[model samples]
Target: MTWRLVRYELAMIRRNRHAWWTLLTLAALALLSFANLSLEAARANADKREVAAAERERWLGQGEKDPHSAAHYSIFAFKLSPTLATLDSGIEPFVGQSVWLEAHHQNDMLDRPQQKASLLQRAGLASPAGLILTFAPLVAFLLAFVAVAQDRERGTMRLALGASAHPRTIVRAKTLAIWGGMAALLVLPLAALALMVAAIGGRLDTDILLRVMAWTVLMSAYLALLAGIGIVVSLRAPNARIALVLLFALWIAMALVLPRTASSAVDALRPLPSSQAVRQQMLDEAAAYWTAEDTKRHQAQLLARYGVARLEDIPNARMAELDMVERHSHQVFDRVLGALYGRVADQDRLFSGLGFLSPTVAAQSLSASVAGSDFSHHHHFIVSAERYRRDLVNAMNADGMAHRADSNERHINDVRLWSAIPEFTYPEPTLGGTSGTAIPALVALALWLLAVTFLVDRAARRLMP
Candidate 1:
């Protein structure tokens, strides 16, 4: 009986031209956005490879020079776009894609795409993820807002209530039918895209497939929550007009207003220092701590270690001083940069916590994390780059110490030493490692679904014509 009623509701929905048009329009937008992003990601990855190769060539071909000078002529580490970057560009547009890994400083990533974007692209919704988050809820509400209210207005809901033993059963059937339609609208194109990618020889590895599954599940739940809310509101409203007004108001609050407000509130609460300030702080502290006295003390230790009477008597004194400077500067970078990263994490946590109020926030957070375009993913690349820089500098210093002459001769190294430093490779982010943001987002979505389900059930029990 329930299935029969669901079929009936679905049939009625199928006959509604408006619903079909909305679904088709949204699907078109999603696919177009997906295709555009996929192409952009492909181009970006190709460019990254080409630039990285050129940088390596430049580094290796610079011929024999001092190892210390070679360290300063370091290569730039470019970040490759993840496979799922097409699904959600996330923070990738705002955050730069490459970092210079030279000695004595940890540089921030450069080449932000947002700087080159036009006003229209910046202000409007342009990505697949944005389309889904903003429009999918509207579509769900549009379809389900008139579910019970229109039936009541046309004098058929009373007939529906009398046909079923309990009002909840009829309501449940309608809700399922509406949510099922939304699920189809959401999942079908995604499935088609996956198959298309596979047909084109794109590798959907286990991890990528798992991320896709998780993304689909989360988006489905979010759409279901919206559908259920629409039906519940429709059941409680006096008529279809009132139902739509209420649903549109709710949509505006959730989809448009609350997200921006929450972001502003987070910034107000945990504001981060500017890049200039951070750099100056690092330089100031490093200079204050590594004074001439500290350098003299380090020289004394180096001489004592080498069983020499003076700094000049110590073998490779220049390399020893360079090594000491690099080691001490590491402490300053950790202290200053660590604070900056902590604030970023705090802001992220605060924003995620705001998801309790807006499911859009939770959905977006989860989407970005799964797509590997979130700040956490970018942060991992930066940390890795810094580690690589340290290793490269340390390797240069080690070579200088091993080969420099005692007569204050200029020590030169060839391509052999430059090629010794391994090329930077960004490690892939695992689901477990990125769960910091994803887990919180998942929890928020679950709570929203659970709370909405309870409201839906209560509305079902009190459902009237």
Candidate 2:
């Protein structure tokens, strides 16, 4: 009987011309956006490779330069986009794609797309994930908001109840039908587009396939929850008109207002210092720590360690001072920059907590984490690049120390030392690392679905003809 009712509801939806048009329009929009973003990701990745190769050649071609000069002439580390970035760009556009790994100073990443975007592009653009989060709920409301109210208005609901149809069963069947229709219309189309984007970007792999599956399942659950909410609101509303208005208002609050408000609140609660301010702070600390007195103290320590009475007696004593300064700068960066990054993590956690109020927050968090475009993934690349820079600079200093030269002489090295430093390759973002953020979001989504399902069942028991 439930199966029959579900089939009947699905047939009604199939016959609704307006619903079909809306779903088709949504699918078309998603596909177009998917294609655009996928091409962009492909281009960005290609640029990353090209730049990396050119940078390497440039470094190696710098013939017979001082090791310190080579360190100063450091390479740029460009982060390649993950395949899933085509689906949800997350923070990629706002954050720069590449960092300059130079000596004595950690340079900011450059080439932020947002800075280059035109007004029209900024205002009109929507990602596949953005469309799903904003428009899919509206579509779900359109599909299910009148399911029971129209029946009750036309007297068929009373007829069915009098003819021995269970209200809970009817409600459950309608919920299933609504969820199935939504998944078929929105989820399946977007999932297909995501896979196509990955393939076109030449990154279709086992991990990507698994991530796509997880994305599909997550979206399906979200749709189900929305469908249940729409159905319950229809069941309880006094009339179809009231149900439509209430559902539309609910959609506005959930999809538009809450997310923006939550973000603003998070920013207000934990404001981060600007990048320039942080950089200046690091420079000031370095300046204060590398004073003349400190350098003299460091030189004395080196002399004592080498069992030499005078600075002239120590070989490569200047290299030792430079090395000590480099090491001290590392501590300064950690103390200042580390605090800034810690605040970002705190903000993310606070935003995740806001997921209880809006499922969009939870959905976005999970999507970005799976896509490897989240701040955590970006931070990992940064940490790795910094470590490489440290190794490169230290290696250069060590080379200068090893080559026995007079205090007045400069140590010049060839391509061998430059070639000795390994290229910077970012580690793949694992599911395990994402689990810390993803698990909380998954739980939030589950709690929301379960809560809405319970509401639907309870409302159905009191559902009037």
Candidate 3:
């Protein structure tokens, strides 16, 4: 009987010309979005590799210069997007995509896509993920808000109940029917997305498969939650119009308002200091710590270690001194930057705490984390880049100290030394380390699912003829 009822509901939707039109339009959008994603991801990946290669060539091609001067003219650390990140950029667009690894100054990410995009694109409707997060629920709500209420108004609900189908059975069938329609709507679009990825030579590896599965699960949960909410509201409301108003209100609260408000609340609760102030402090402290007297002491110590009595007696006197300066800068940068990052992390935790009120937050959080585009993902890139910068600087300095003999007519280091430092490589993120954020979000989504189910069950039991 439940299956029969579910099928009957689905048949009604299939017969609705407007519903078919909406589904067709959504499929078109999804196809276009995924195609763009595949093409852009391929293009972006190629551009990053080209830029990195150019930088490497420039570094190797440079003529005679001091190693320390070369260190000051550092390479840029590019934040390359994961192939799947094109599906949902999460916080990537708003944040910096590259940072200069030059001496004496630690840079935040530069070239935020937000800065380059139009005002319209910044309005949140520019991406398909935005469309899904903001509009899919509305589509579900509109379909299901009248499912039970209108049936009750027309007396078919009583007919079904009097025919020995319990309220629970009928309500469950209605919910299933609505979600099934959404699945039908998604079938073609999802298939097209797969074809698009293949067309662009994107691999369907284990990680990509897992990521796609995770996305599917979250999106299904989201739609099911919305469908259930709509049905519950419909079951209890006196009429269809009021039922829609109530469902729309719920959607707005969860999707639009909470996400924006949570971030604002976090910033207000724990404000971080300005980057310029911290940077200036680091520079001043470094200058104070590496003064002329300190340099004399350091150089004397280097000469003593090498068993030489004169300043020029040691082959790498300046090399050792520059290394000392860099070591000092690393300590200062770590302490100062560590404190600020802690504040940013606190803000993130506070926002996660607010996830208890909105499943959309939880879904989006897990979605981005799974895609490796979250704050943590970007943080790992920055830290890795900084480590590379430090190692690269130390390596060149060490080479200079050992090999820069006054008698070597080639007074300047050449390509051999320049190419000796290995290229910087970023490691992939392990999801096992994502427990910090993932656990909280997963729990929140579970709780919301339980809440939605409980409400639906209660409404089912309370239904009247």
Candidate 4:
């Protein structure tokens, strides 16, 4: 009986020209998004390689600079594109891609791609992920909002209920059919993306494939929730139009208004200081502290901990060695900056925590996280870049310390040392790592799915008569 109803529902959807047209439109949009992503990914990869080559040339060109001077003239490292970044772009386009690793302060990533793009990119184009995760679900809502109400208005519900078919079975069949259509709309574009990536010599990870599958399941579940909500509204409302209005209002609240409001509230509650301001303040404080007598005593203590009797007695070479020590002092200042930055990130996490109240937000956040497009993913990139910076600077400083005997020594310049330094490389984090960070959002989605399923069952029983 359920199979019969499912077949009937599928046939009904196929016969609806509007539904077919909407699905076709969605498929077209998804394909376009995939193309855009592939183009952008190719561009980003090319840019990264170019920058890396330029850095290599510049380092090798530094004929015979002292190792300490090389440390002070550290190279910039660009973040590499993740395999799945093309699908979602996420914060990659908005955040800076490259970091300058000079001797002192850890520089923030600079040159946001979004700043170079047209304004429309900021509002969001119909990216494949966005179409599936966002727009297609809305399209499903449009299809389902009048699924039962139209039948009732036309007396089909009464006729069906009078037959041997159970109302619960009827609702389940309807949901399954609509969900099938939604899945196709989503999967077609993703299949195209897979093909495009394969054609471009990109390697796809099994974990990424699994993440995409999970994302698909989440999207389908969200559509099911919307379908269930639509049925309940249709059963309760007097007419199809009212059912749509109610569903639209619900969609607005969940999909549109709440996420932004929560984000705004979180910002107000825990404001983050600008990166520029943070950097400037750290530099000022470091200068003041280094100059102060009490601060000098503290430095003396640090040097003592390192088993050094005096600054000159410390086993190091020239003015360059002194510069390296000054650089280490700046590193201490950066630690203070990192603590403050962590506080702000904690506040952002607190905001993301509210995803429980809105499943749309939860699904969106979880999808992005699993795909490595979330803020945490970007943060990991920045942190990785910083680690590389430290490595590069330390390598150069070690050479400086070995070559020069005292702060007064004019060191021999050896450009060969500069060429030997390793170029920075960025490794994209795994989906498993990012998904672990997204468990809360996934749980929230599960709870909402359960709640909607329960409500659908309850509503079906009530509407049976």
Give each model's clash number. 0, 0, 0, 4
Error of 4 at 355 (Å): 1.9
> Model 1, range 329-408, lDDT digits (tens) per residue?
89989989988988898888788888998999888888888877788888888888899999999999889888755645
Model 2: CA > 4 A from native: 118-125, 199-202, 288-294, 304-307
Report the backbone clash tally of model 4.
4
- Candidates' lDDT values, in order? 0.81, 0.81, 0.74, 0.70
Candidate 2 structure quality by residue, lDDT tens digits, 216-335: 888888889888988988888888899989989999999889988989999999899998799889888886346678777888888878898987776677777777778888999889
RMSD versus native structure for model 2: 2.2
Q: What lDDT is reached at residue 464 by model 1?
A: 57
Across 368-424, the per-residue lDDT of candidate 4 in tens digits comes to 776677777887887777777777777776666665366456455565677667767
lDDT of 3 at 342: 73
Tens-digit lDDT track for model 3 on 1-465? 889989998877667666556656765676566666666667766787789888888888886687767777778777777655655667777888778876655667888878877664577555556566777777777778557766777888899888888889889999999887776565335634654574466455666666766677777787788788888888888887788688789789888898888778878998988878877777776763466787778877777777888867766666766777778778988998888877777766667767787877777777677777777777788788898888878877777777655533323577787788777677656654543655677788889899999999999999865
Better structure of 1 and 4 per TM-score:
1
**Model 1, residue 100: what's the lDDT?**
93
Candidate 2: C-alpha lDDT: 0.81
